[model samples]
Target: MTDKLKDKIEKFLAMCLKSKSEKEGDTSIKVDELTEEQHREIAEDAVAITNSLVELQRLLPVSRKLAELGYLLEVQGKITVKAGEAYDEAALNFFSDMYGGGIALSKRLH
Candidate 1:
């Protein structure tokens, strides 16, 4: 897929896939394009920082969208608060798969 297309798909996934605030909804698509591993890989990289603070802000909204938002690190299976963490720290702990966190895909999928 082209870069533009990838970005669009990623954005759609984020919006439709739902979060704590976004309730479950119907989403139907014939996704034979990307393999399961590919999908996982893309998601793993979904919250990557581009060295842009504006982009970084998405993972750590200053208005405290992440206030009630707590990360449930997969490996540890514990909730980490986002209240007072720095932007980078919040982003890393909240969305870094390498460290057992990231918008929990399993929770989002279910």
Candidate 2:
């Protein structure tokens, strides 16, 4: 995909994620009331991200970077939740797979 298209897709995904995170807030406010067109756009963007990750997984170095990128994306998503914002699960899960189930574990002391 062209750079312009990729940028648009990324923005759409981010907006949808933000909308979801906002709904998780304690204030009990409704989401931003996105239009049907906006929802469709978000869905398309999610598909694009998933496809790109799949292709990137075929390359060793790129695959490694993809996993790290996934971790960063998940971290950003969690930060949005902590800030009382919303995030899309599709976007979160896409990265989760790349990062091997999404949570990093540390070894316990013996």
Candidate 3:
């Protein structure tokens, strides 16, 4: 990727992280009484993150790699007893092996 594209990717990833953090904070805030405006604000933030996630899925291979890793972690130990359960773990391991693990994958992609 060009340096400019790489910078854009990094900024996008930072936005993803920030959105996630904000969502977590919003969840906590939701316990308190919220006005309609506040509720709309929270909903809009969630929608923004969801839309960004969809865009990232299209734009970044690393996002897929990380998602596969998460799936693999969820299913790694139960492959033999349950093939369905193993799918996630196998996928995670496959991506990790394919890309030399998460850190390397992110660095190489960005």
Q: Indicate which candidate wins on TM-score.
A: 2
lDDT tens digits, residue span 1-110, model 2: 99999788667666666766677753332234556676687688788888998776766565556556555666876422334332344334564556645454332222
Clashing pairs in 3: 72-88, 72-89
- Lowest summed lDDT across 10 adjacent residues in model 3 is found at 26-35
Question: What TM-score fits each model?
Answer: 0.21, 0.30, 0.29
Better of 1 and 3 by TM-score: 3
- Please state every model's RMSD to the true fold in angstroms: 18.5, 18.5, 14.1
For candidate 1, the TM-score is 0.21
**Which should have the higher TM-score, number 2 or number 3?**
2
Please identify which of the two predictions, 2 or 3, would achieve the higher lDDT against the true structure. 3
lDDT of each: 0.51, 0.59, 0.60
TM-score of 3: 0.29
